[model samples]
Target: MLEMLDNPQLVKIHFETHDDLVLVWANGAPPLVAEFVQVKGAEADKLWSVADLCLRKKQAVGSSIFEKSLDRDQHEETACFRIVTLRPVVSALTPLTYKRGNEARAIDCDEMVALKADLDGRMPNVVSKRGNGTGYWLDNCQWDARHDEVAVKTHNRMRLFEIMQAAGSLLLLEHIDILLDELRKLVKTAGDAKWKPDKAKKILTRKAFLTMWDACLAKLKDDAAQPSGGKLIEKMSNASLTGTVVAMAVDMRLDYARSVRTSRYMQPDEASQLQGRVKSEVQNLSAKRAAGTLDLDGPAFHALCVDRMDAINASLPADQGDRSAFLKGCMYDIADRCLLRFDRTGL
Candidate 1:
């Protein structure tokens, strides 16, 4: 979660006993307000449409404002009330294809409308009156509320990461790993002494360690951009992100190769075999073209590829049950790769 909201200037208080996620922004910027957020879906199996959850007395955003331990006298009041949900709200007015990315699914429009209606009635702050001898009116009750959907939680971490970057947080890679290891011991030794709000505030407010963090970030950035940094970049680039992209490329094999540039998943041994197969077939096509046995024209080459792929699929084992779809799809992927290679290298 720290990595998700990776802003150095933004410190979150995790009290180990509160439902409220408090965000304190101490960038010394004027008018910057603190945010109090409620994240739902911690106990739910699935998310549904409608605002039933929003008005819940214990867990909803509206109630959180009152339930939170923010002492108004201590200047801990927040200006933003937010709820983050894991699932999409599906409603009647929702488009059939609500989400564009394959990773993120769409929500129902009817569900969204219900939630919006429920929140609209409660939001923008409403004050009630009691006809007692003393007269008191509510002021400074305005707040901004938002309901957010974070698509596949694991898959779309980059969105949160980009937010961290935009907030001037550096992605320190290995250097951070080392610093964090040292920090773990530092924190452990410091014990609860530094855990107090005032003591902790001293850490960020004084900017005592800011120079050290800055130096490390600058050094890491400089090292990563130098000629020697090619190895670091390669190591970092070939992480699980490369495998994820490779899996996607394999899924979209029948399509163009635009998504295959980062292809890095298949085992080296298996890749060698596929490489051999591709080269052998390319060589055979080149020989046929040279001997005038095969036409090299665009349409002829395309037709020839289709015929060759069909022949290849015909050799699939007879036991391959329901042979129509998988066999055909496999053939298309190989054929598409071949065509893509030829287009790229003309070999």
Candidate 2:
């Protein structure tokens, strides 16, 4: 599924079909190619052999793994086949392993002769009736093995994280968990039994999948933008803040308010003057943010505000210049009062 998402050429995925999965690829119109995939979860110690592939339940004709893989040969569109498993293949099938530049593996002379002879004796009509010879089927078949379920999940998570980063998603790890769960539910729903036109519901098209992905990302961003309760916290929420910074912002807002009430080390006039300066700087930063001249994201925006406040403190008269922390608190107090906003304008 991760592979399907990564490939731009993939058009649709059909789950629980004649094959375990069918990946349809097309450039524009009707001449789509289908890659039929048969997924098998083999025992930990098992290795797939020629005999295993040729075996059929009740020794029935057209029921062997190879025959089932070729069933789609009767379809109009070009077809390729794959047997994806959790166990490795024996020596004769080693050439079918999926690797870079090795999507298809042709049977060698010796193995082809022996295997073809055996299959012909078991299912001669099936071999002779293929539009292309049995050799073509063998050449197009791929055997991809050792796909451990747990390892695949880990890989898919890493792939999803990369996708989020590429999309500039502000979501964190917990959010990724939520998104993955939602996506799994979507896959399960798509896998449910449905016929003909309704089977369209069973097929996940790339365009539709991407639309859902984009909508999920947009909702996460919207949810993050909503006010998170306390006055200062609400202001910080606009900035997309979380964890320690939010707690720190709350503390700063309270301390700055307390200092204003008691006039701890500074006079009332000094506090008022400092407040005006902080407001001026914030306005300037807000303008820059609006103009898109500052490209910083949420946390970077917060850090930039802190640095600007520290610079403001340094420029003040000696006694005032020493109170950098107090100035930072003053900034948060201004935010609490709605006189300052950490987020970019119109964002």
- Give the winner by TM-score: 2
TM per candidate comes to 0.32, 0.60
Give a tens-digit lDDT track for model 2, residues 157-201. Answer: 677766644554423334556778888888788777675667777
Query: Candidate 1's residue-wise lDDT over 216-275, tens digit each?
Result: 546645443332423322322332224453343344332212111212332223333433
What's model 1's overall lDDT?
0.38
Cα lDDT, model 1, residue 170: 30
